[model samples]
Target: MNRLTLCAAALAATALGAPALARAEDGRWQIKLLGSGVLPDGRIDGVKTDLIGLPAGSRTRADDNVVPTMAIEFYATPNLSIETICCLTQHKVDGAGALAGARIVDHVLILPATLTLKYHVDAGPIRPYVGLGPSLFVIMGEKPGATAKALGASRVTMSNELGLVLQGGVDIPVGDGGLGINFDAKKYFVDTIARFTTTAGVKALETRHKLDPWVISGGVYFSF
Candidate 1:
């Protein structure tokens, strides 16, 4: 099965069984396993330099990815916590419009690392939260795609960037136990500059990109 289907099934099953293992929440730490959707809006912001002539109406888009993630949270008080997640997400950028059906970059692996300070409140049995944080999109690896190679691009590199993230979510306690279902969403504001080096060892092209991704997740959390 695909990753999304697998994750959804796991989430549903665990949530359904949460009540049986539920206990009172008296611990300061919580751990979670979540299925996440990495939806990115990767579009060209500007072409700073281009040795190869790009067609008019040239545009780019990034395909989305789904992956499993683990989160750790430490609650210092009843209403405050520090949270972070561990995961790696990968995506590809493809040409659009005039360069339709062409791949520009591939295997762009990223570690979207974040550290947030969260505020929580209770609405009956539901714990709702909001968070703000700084984020770093670490470019673990990337390379030129087939189309880029055809255009004489021999190397590709993207800059790692710092950005801000806003988060919101809710947790539903199924019983007295700390077992619960969690749903969360985070919005990121980030930008990166891409450089393409040709076989002649010259920087042939450079462009700026905006990759503001919306990270949506659903899963189960254990408080202890």
Candidate 2:
């Protein structure tokens, strides 16, 4: 009789453990840190040509840039979640030949923040995900060489920006209790539609730029 009771208890334990293991495989929370390299086009048209001139109407170029970002996510369901990310980056513009001449055109800080809705696909220990969202950007700095006191060809204060962000990535599980490695990519669809204010007046200019930048990074994720 005792042997039969022991066998029944063993069966019940296995049943309970199986369901708990299944739940752990279902839902989770994640976080990521991004290291990115970017390139910018620093050109302004429709302004006073006497300040800096390349051709009649030409654009300026800047060097490649590097930036860092961070994000947090909550898994509302096993395959769905919401996320937000923030980044800091710098930009510059310079003279091309006898035109504007050589100088560190601008030095400023750029902050782009975004919110996204994500969907994940289960593929063994590795899961892949994709998302879409909107973003807000603020650019503060100046151009390379102007005598005007405000920016004087060295800075521009502000820009009101509207943009879109698209993202995709994967996660790999490492150990127990929701520890893993994460990877993701993001793109910002934006344009420079800003007006510079000087003693002359407000002038509208369009700055050409790159839209998609590659991001390869790793961080930690915790499950609740």
Candidate 3:
């Protein structure tokens, strides 16, 4: 079985043994599918426009791209949990005004996985929690067009990313052991080490890009 399934089984076994686990479901595992949105930023390094008499516009856009995410969380204690999310992301790059036709779409798979420790506060039927953790992220994509002259026919590439994460959430219990609803928000301090190449004998293009985005998600949680 997968790690999530294993976690769930462990939680179930623990719940059967301890009254705290049975009542609070302290070690339960949670899974969620989150609809997410990505904010993209751009930067061009090591290339000077005005100094080299070149008119290169290296500006980032504030376009929000929607993506889908899958997550698995495990509660070590009733008040503490750790989670990971995977987002399938795609970005469109427009080559300024004159070179608008030279646009490209980059398909990125982003995994913002975190290992957080949370502290929950009980408030009647509502539970609120806050967490801080370390995160690792990976970003990868394919070349916009394989036969494009500029890209030189590079098909696919990948990046290694690392970051920190901060998160908070609230849970609204429906009925006794029936179902629960959850709402959470997270922010990732992500940085990517990107390396790519093209078929035009270009070996490698390496750069480190940084970005931070806030994510909001809601889902249902069922406890037995």
TM-score of each: 0.86, 0.67, 0.67
lDDT by residue for model 1 (155-217), tens: 999999999999999988778888999999999999999999988889988999999999999
Candidate 3 per-residue lDDT over residues 50-141, each given as its tens digit:
22122345332223576555555667676666555555455644443333444433455454555566788978789898888776665554
- Tell me the tens digit of each residue's lDDT in model 2 across 1-224: 34234323433332333333334346554656556665554445334324333355344556667665566666667788777666656666565544454443456555565677789898887899999887776665544344223343322444547788788888887887677777777776765543334545543232444323333445655555
Highest lDDT: give the candidate number.
1
Error of 3 at 33 (Å): 3.8
Q: Candidate 3: list runs displaced more than 4 Å.
A: 1-26, 42-57, 95-105, 145-148, 151-158, 195-198, 203-207
Better of 2 and 3 by lDDT: 2
Q: What's the residue-level lDDT of 193 in candidate 3?
A: 45
> In model 1, where do residues sit more than 4 Å from their true spots?
1-27
Each prediction's number of clashing residue pairs: 3, 11, 0
